[model samples]
Target: MTANTRAPQQERSRATQQRLLEATVECLVEFGWSGASTTVIAERAGVSRGAQLHHYPTRAALVLAAVEHLSERRAAEIRAEAAALTGDPEDRVEQVIDMLAAAFTGPLYVAALEVWVAARTDLDLKAALIPLEARVGREMHRLTVDLLGADETRPGVRESVQATLDLLRGLGVANLLSDDSHRREQLLAAWKRQLTTAIREP
Candidate 1:
């Protein structure tokens, strides 16, 4: 086959791969990891089963790709939001906290929980989550250091920021399990108060 003839075929293959990845995410969100079969994903992508298999031969490979895709998109959004803050260090920190809180309480949070649940039973899923979780932690720590002007290398800085992140993550999970917005707001307010007090301390 000529290179010129292969170009269109390559472009079409790339498009099909992208569509399959997108469909995998949608199926995961709608049906959870266990229910997201290759057949269902192919159907959702409007591609043939053979095409889906050609791109992602194994379920683990497909799920890993989808998870990586989601993680990258979320990280970009978080970094962009953090970069957009314009204010003093304290204000920037507050903005970062608020942005993280929103992320934890929204669709991303729900999707994360779904992935976590799947990870418990699927070794590939669990393996995929490790680096993504580390990246998120590193990014959060970087944002905290930038906003607070803290030396991230300092003994206490990592602990303090990680504590705050842990609290927010827990709040997100709690909020997801319950339908009470008032309780969620109360929890967030309490966290804000704690953050303010921490910032005032030597």
Candidate 2:
């Protein structure tokens, strides 16, 4: 009887935590770090401030947890998308390029950009965030390599692959405020051609 009750209670606690974390990301994406106060997060989560504090005592703690949650959610999404690809070479190239490009421009990137920009001045936040960013970077790199069957061991292959992601990330960040869609589209097309050519190296 006690075990049955405990399991349900534990599940409820997990659900509440998940709601709080999701709300944190929503706040970060919409209003940035300064606006994502604990009160606002609690209200967004539809939980009481006391309940939120019980889960996460500090702003950095709450936001950092949200970042980890976002990384896990996004990585799973990328993995599923990668697994669903068919084996046609031309189709795969287009699909993979589109996936990588889309991944960098969406809500997940916006939420992360908010945290990264805030972390620039907050040493404590930076300390907490750097390892999470590194882990996510590694996961993204592995996902890209697998999605494209990239031969990372080939000469210059690894650096080129890293550069591709870096370029997309920079472009994604730029898209936050710019309306340069025409130029972005041109650059993206050029990148696709270059990546396809590089991958076909003898």
Each candidate's lDDT (Cα)?
0.75, 0.86
Summarize candidate 2's per-residue lDDT along 1-202 as a digit string, tens digits. Answer: 5998999988988998999999999998888878989899899999988888888989889989999999898888887897899998767766887788787888889899999999999999999999989998998888888887888888877887899899989888888886656777788888878887787687
Provide the lDDT at 130 for model 1: 80
Error of 1 at 38 (Å): 2.3
Model 1 superposed RMSD (Cα): 2.9
RMSD to the true structure for each prediction, in A, is 2.9, 1.4
Displacement of residue 171 (Cα, Å) in model 1 is 1.9
- What would the per-residue lDDT of candidate 1 be over residues 82-186, giving only the tens digit for each residue? 778886765766677788777777765666677778887888767877887677668766766665566555456667777887887887877765665687677
Regions more than 4 Å wrong, model 1:
1-11, 127-136, 143-149, 196-202
What TM-score does candidate 1 get on C-alpha atoms?
Answer: 0.80
Name the best candidate (by TM-score).
2
lDDT for 180 (candidate 1): 53
Query: In candidate 2, which residue pairs clash?
Result: none
For each candidate, give its TM-score against the true structure: 0.80, 0.95
